[model samples]
Target: MISKIELLNEIGIALSAEKNSQKVLELILDGAKKLTNADGGSLYTLNDKDELVFEIVSTDSLDIHMGGTTGQSIDFPPLPLHIEGHDNLSMVVTSAVLNDNTINIHDAYHADGFDFSGTRKFDENTGYRTKSLLTIPMKNHKADIIGVLQLINSTSIDTGVVVDFSSEDQKLAESLASQAAVALTNKKLIDEQKALFEAFIKLIATAIDEKSPYTGGHCKRLPELTMMIADACDKDDAGALKDFKMTEKDRYELMIAGWLHDCGKVTTPEYVIDKSTKLETIYDRINTVNARFEVLKRDAKISMLEKQMTARETADEQAFKDAERDYEALIEKLNDDKEFISVANVGGEYMAEDKQERVREIAKYKIDDCEEERCNFFNEDEIQNLTIAKGTLTNEERQVINNHIVVTIKMLDQLPFPKHLENVPEYAGGHHERMDGKGYPKGLTRDQMSWPARMMGIADIFEALTARDRPYKDGKKLSVCLDILGKMRLDNHIDPEIFDVFVREKVYMEYASEFLTPDQIDEVDHSKIPGFSGD
Candidate 1:
């Protein structure tokens, strides 16, 4: 006679070992197989509707991954062998549902007119010896039947062949199920934690976008671009990145990096952040330039009348004619100037040195017969000393623009980032820095930069180079942007290795495909990504 002690010990062993569900299930099946000495066993876990979810095999795939369904979920409900006429497994399940304690039914397989819906699984696939079987409901302390545990080929341990279902084995089967209930509960908790973390990260990204009206699309676009680059790089090899298989850790890092890359912008002042033009504050220098052009026109008219008098080409003829034409032409060129042109240009946002000097020559010189200095020009020294090239502004206005990096760094420094995310503040702040130590907020150099910092640098340049929202500058075409970035790399303004990876992987194509606006997307020339095997 088997004692309750042995059954209690088996349940204790099953519950004590801590592991994931798959490993725990294997242990359960192993104990079942050993107690019954069956050829092998399968553990059937049910869904909420009592339907089979997974039929976990005790053996490995190498040990005959049966085709006709030895180790798969069944199409029909498997019938228990213990009761005839009524479905035996259904009766056993009903007992658990109602908390009934109906005991052992002998000669279950030999019951009259019995048919096995699971027979095809056994008789067709394995064809191993099978006869008597034992099954019992697996339940938790709450009396919920988590699943059913079964032992096949049950026999009198004293005898060599299969025999009737014994009372001792019945008690043991129920014990293992209780252990499985705990494992199920643990898995559910882990899934909930993972989902909560993902939602939290998305919330942070949304908060960053809310800071500035212009940046409402920034958080969304950056990740799209970052992932595109990763995808392009992924296509280069066998769906891996630099000898790594794009694991969960790598994906998590990229996602966090993309989201927090601009967290430093939180410190950036609102006015400077939205400073639409070079001469954005303290003065609308366009007004001042227009006023200067009027003075030039008035002086030109005087010069023309004087010329006419000197030539006896008579003042009466020249009086009504417009000598303001030459002055108008100069004003038009100053108001609508483009970048990277002659230093002899002026107006719009900034005044060139030569342009400032010429304006000074015209206005600053006393006519040798003036009343007061109503039209003095900005001297070259005063023009060179200010951040605003054309407009006059207080020191505070310029400081606000430079303080954006300071804001970004301060906000991120407060967050509790994982150790791997330690570089986020520095990486983000370094975007505005230049190669020649001319960049702001602690101008880091090539040697001081990390891969993440470099990634941020590239992403910043890429976005600004292609952005269509700047009031002072027109967006560049993709081809032009790429050429500019290539030159920046050549000029030591950007990291060479990163640029090499970008060109080799054709990274911009992936970014452009996703982040670029519809009009921009259509116009871009995308290079083919070489190794896009996302297996």
Candidate 2:
């Protein structure tokens, strides 16, 4: 008792709402059979080779269904459009598409001007009579035939007897096919555009990664970790983040943000990023200091020989002995200073006050009469490098490194993102921010930032802490990295709830198993970690 116009309008609405291609195909075929009162239907689309491939098939009398939403694949070969350079118009589906006309046959057994051998074989095998074929070409908005909708064996609604497809049924089927075609075309275009967009994003990430070998793995792994922890949060209903949930669109937005979190690093100089030692600029200046020590040794040797010559003339044995002792003492002092400078060049978590003062004191001594300019034992620049309180980078270099996040925000903000992805800049830019508002750029506190942004913060930090490919320092062990992260959580540097989920889900262990070396993966005591509970 369904009105044909009302049904067609409903089908159009349903088709437009569906986003999945296969689901759209299934819905179209199912709607066509229902509108025509047909017992079975099949949908086919043109493949790359210009052949009609069976995408979905349904038979109500035989209780058979395959392809599309059925979770079954159609194993049938594609129906070729041409045979040996001539149009293969022998088939009803192809003929409809090639001629751009609807083919409505009263009975397949009595139909002429087309081949029904395949239809007869199907009927014979299944003991089902084939009759009343109504085939329509699916034309898109561009007036191009994208696919064909074929319905078979129209039946009387009351008696269940075979019948011809009425003219009214043909009109309804054609209208539904048109709507379905537009829906499918729009979905295909959106899907294709999304694929291209994601690929370009990854390309940018790859370029940034290849810019510096030390951080090559980071650009790829942080998004994955972000997703892992975010997914865990979505599933955990018992935690403080139990209310947190994400849709497919939300997940995609976060993923894009994660990949672009360090995009600003592309603007950073490789020299600053690759600085492995404190005294390193173009090269480590420790070698320059080592050369100075050699000059001092040479000077001591010459002074000793001169004193020996003077002592021999005067027969001053005690003075000669005294000169020899003085020369040895000077050489010993030079060796100690060289060792200290070499150690300082390596850089560490801390450089003691005395060590820094000693660097200043050493800078006062000039290397006299060298091949190059008479420079200090350590030049001004070298002294500044050696006296760095921590790590290899100076204050200026750290600022340059930190500015990448600022650049990332600026770059992402300029893009014309749609409504769903409008927060990409905020999410990516906020990863460097701390929960206590101590982070850079915007300095957003825990509540100011979104959940996904906070999750990305943990991801960025954990990846850096455990990354094995960094040029400056060795990747820390799992226990060590987790210990540091746990302390950070207590210190309000990271979100406590997210960190707890990260620990409870063992996401770190999963990442380590895949990306970390065997030695870096070690047993961890969750209870011992600060701000962490075994829950």
Over the stretch 1-535, how does candidate 2's per-residue lDDT look in tens digits? 3586777788889888888888899899988988888999999998788899999999999999999989888898999988899998999998998889999999888888899999899989999898889999999999999999999989998999989999989989998988888898999999999999999889889999988777887989999999999999999998688899899999999999988888888889989988888877888777877887898899889999999889989999988998999999999998998898888888876899999999898787777655666766766677788899888888989999999999999999899999999989998999999999999988899999999999999999999999877765789999999999999999999999999999988999988988899999999988888889777
TM-score (all chains, Cα) for each model: 0.57, 0.93
| Candidate 2 backbone collisions, by pair | none
| lDDT (CA) per prediction | 0.55, 0.90
Count of backbone clashes, every candidate in sequence: 7, 0
What is the model-wide C-alpha lDDT for candidate 2? 0.90
RMSD (CA, Å), each prediction: 9.2, 2.3
User: Which candidate should be chosen as best, given lDDT against the real structure?
Assistant: 2
